[model samples]
Target chain A: MYQTNQYEGMIAETVSMRGHNGDVINAYVARPLGAGPFPGMVVIHHAPGWDEWYRECARRFAHHGYVSISPNLYFRDGHGTPEDVGAKVRAAGGAPDARVLGDLDGANAWLRSLPYVSRKVGIFGTCSGGRQAFLAGCRLKGLDAVIECWGGRVVQSKEELTPNQPVAPIDYTKDLSCPIIGIFGNEDKSPTPEQVNAHEAELKKHGKQYEFHRYEGAGHGFFYYDRPAYRQEQAVDGWKKVLAFTEKTLR
Target chain B: MCTMIAHQVRIQGRGKSGPEWFEVHEANVSYDHPYDLPLEHALNIDFVNETLGPGARVAVELSVDAARQLVKTIEAVLAQADQRGVLEDRPVAAEPARSPSVA
Candidate 1:
C-alpha cells in the first residue's frame, strides 16, 4: 500500500474501563481519527509495568489502521512511576494470572464496543505479557490472534511456579483457540531453544495454527531498543513477522 | 524473559533523596533487566520506604563483578572495624516487624 500526501490523524489518551471482577482500571487507547472501520489490538505491557513503550506501541498500531488499547495491569498497585509500581509488583511475586486474564478480557470487550472497530481483535505481548497473551488465547474468548514475543516461563517447572502463577502455561496448549505467532531470541535463558522446541511439540500435538520466528545471536528482550539487548537486524525482521501475522489473522 | 526474580530484606538506614533524608526500611535485590544499565541483566538494589511513597527510594544497577566487589568491600570494612574493637559484640537480631498496613 502506497499513498502520497494522504491526510493522517490519530488520538492517543488514557481511558477508564472495567477490568477484572468489575474493577475500574485505566487503559491507554490509541485510534485513528478518520476511520470507517479498523481492526483492534489489545497490547499487554511487559512485567516492567504499563509504562511508556506500551503506550507508544498503541500509537504505532493506530498508525497502521488498528485501534489499540493497553490496560494498566498494575493500576491497583497504586499511582507511581513505572519502575516503582513494577518494583512493587515484583516484590509481591507478580500479579495473579486470573486477574491479568480478566483485565485482558475487559480490554478486548472495550475494543469491540468502539464504533470504528472492525470486529477483529488481536493480542500482542512481550516479556511477561507475552506469556499472558498465550494464556489468554487459551483461556479467553473472542480474540482472533495472539502475538507472543519472547514470553519467558511458558514452560515452567513446578518448583518455579508461584502462587500468583500457579499453573504452567504449557498446560493450556490444548485449549488454545486462536492462531499464534511467537518471536524469540535463540539465546534466551528462560525459554531456551530446547524449551521452545518443547513448546512447539506441544502445539504440534494439539495441531494449533502457529508460527515461530527465532533469531540467532540474540537474547531475551532483543526488541527492547532502550536496553542493551536490542538487535536491529533481528528486531526489524521480527517486527515484519509480527505485522504480517497481525495482517493475516487480525486484518 | 521477565525474570520476576527479587528478594526483599528489612534494614534500618537513612537515605538521602534530593535535599531530604528518609528512613529506608527495606531493600530489594534482584538480578534482572536494568532500567539504565548497558547490559541484558544487572544486579539491582532498591532501597525503599513504601510508607514514604515511591519517591523515597534509591536504586542502583551494577554488573555482577561490581556487585561482588561491593559486597566483599562492605564485609572487609566491617571485619576491619571488628578487629580494631570498634564494633560492639551483639547477638543476631530478628527481622524488624513491618508496618501492619504495608501489605
Candidate 2:
C-alpha cells in the first residue's frame, strides 16, 4: 500500500516502477478512495518533470473519480527536480523520442498492473507531455482515449532551432485505436494554425474520432495557472471538455 | 526632475463571465525627488486599465515606495536562495506566421 494524501475527496500516493533496463521510475498516483476497479489515466509530464502543478492536476482528475498517475519521465537521466531536469534537457538539446516512448510504456504497464485500476485506461499530457500522449495513443495497445494540450511539432525539421527529430502524429493517425482530443491556444506560435490543420486532415483521412479546440487570445502555456500566460477561463473550459471526452470514451 | 512610481495590478476572473469587483486602499509613503504631480493619478489609471482591460471595475489606491522596494528585495532574496535544477529550461518556441484556421 502507498502512503496517501487526501485533498478534497481524492487520495494522492507516491509509487515507483521499473522501466527500461530496470531503471527506477517515480510517479504520483491520485484517485478517489474506493475498493472496486476504476478507470485509469496516465498523466505524462511536460519538459519539466513531476512538478507540483502536475500533481495538482492528478488530484483534480482523482477528485473527478478517475485514477491518475503522473510519471517523472526524466528520472532515468538522474534529473530529479524540475529545474535540474529542465537544465539538463537544455544542455542535451532536446528529448530523444526513444527515451520518451520507453518511459510511457513503463508508466502504462504500471497502471495496468494496479489492482484498483479498470481495464479502461486513457493518457493525457501538456506541451511535451501532449506529444507523448499522442504517441501513446498510436503506439500503445489498450488505450481507450488520449488528450493532448498544445503539443508542438506535428512536423519536424532537423535544421530548426529546437533540434526536434519530428515524429509527426499525423503519420500515425491510421494506427490509433481510440479517440484523440487536442486543445490549443490560437495565439501559440509552436503548433501554428497550419500544423493543427495538417493534423486534422490526417485524422480525417484515417476516419479517426478526434476533436480540436482553439481558444482565442490565449497563448502557449495558457493552462498553466502559475504562469503569466494562464487564461483561467479558457483552461477551465478546456478541462471540462477533457473530462467529457474521457468519460465518453472510457466509460 | 521627476521620479515615476510603477505599480502593477492583476485582475482575475472566470470564463466568459464578467470581471469581479475588487477594492484597494491608499497607503502613506514618501515621494523622493519629485513631491507630487497631477499625472500620477492618470498614470496609475492607465497602468490598471492597460493590464486589467476596460471592462474590469477596479478601485484606485497609492502604495508606498518602500513597499515596492521591499517586494523587489524579497524577489531578489528568493532568486538567490533558489537551488538550481539539473535540467536546462528552454524558452517557448518562437511564434510562426499565421496560417488558415482549422475547420
Q: Which candidate achieves the best TM-score against the true structure?
A: 1
Per-residue lDDT, model 2, residue B43, is 23
User: Which residue runs does candidate 2 get wrong by more than 4 Å?
Assistant: A1-8, A158-166, B1-103
CAPRI-style docking class of model 1 based on DockQ:
acceptable
> What are the runs in model 1 whose C-alpha is more than 4 Å off?
B88-103
Best-matching candidate per lDDT: 1
lDDT of each candidate versus the true structure: 0.87, 0.65
lDDT of 1 at B20: 60
lDDT of 2 by residue, A1-251 (tens): 12367434567988897765567878899988886488888887776456788899888888777888887776755533464344234334446666676777777788789888888888999876787688778887888999999876654443342433345655777898899999999887667778778878888998999999999989776788776668899999999999999989887
Q: Which ten residues in a row have the lowest lDDT in candidate 2 chain A?
A: A156-165
Please give, for residues A60-117, the per-residue lDDT of candidate 1 as tens digits: 8888888999999999887778887887777677889999999999999999998899
DockQ of each: 0.41, 0.02
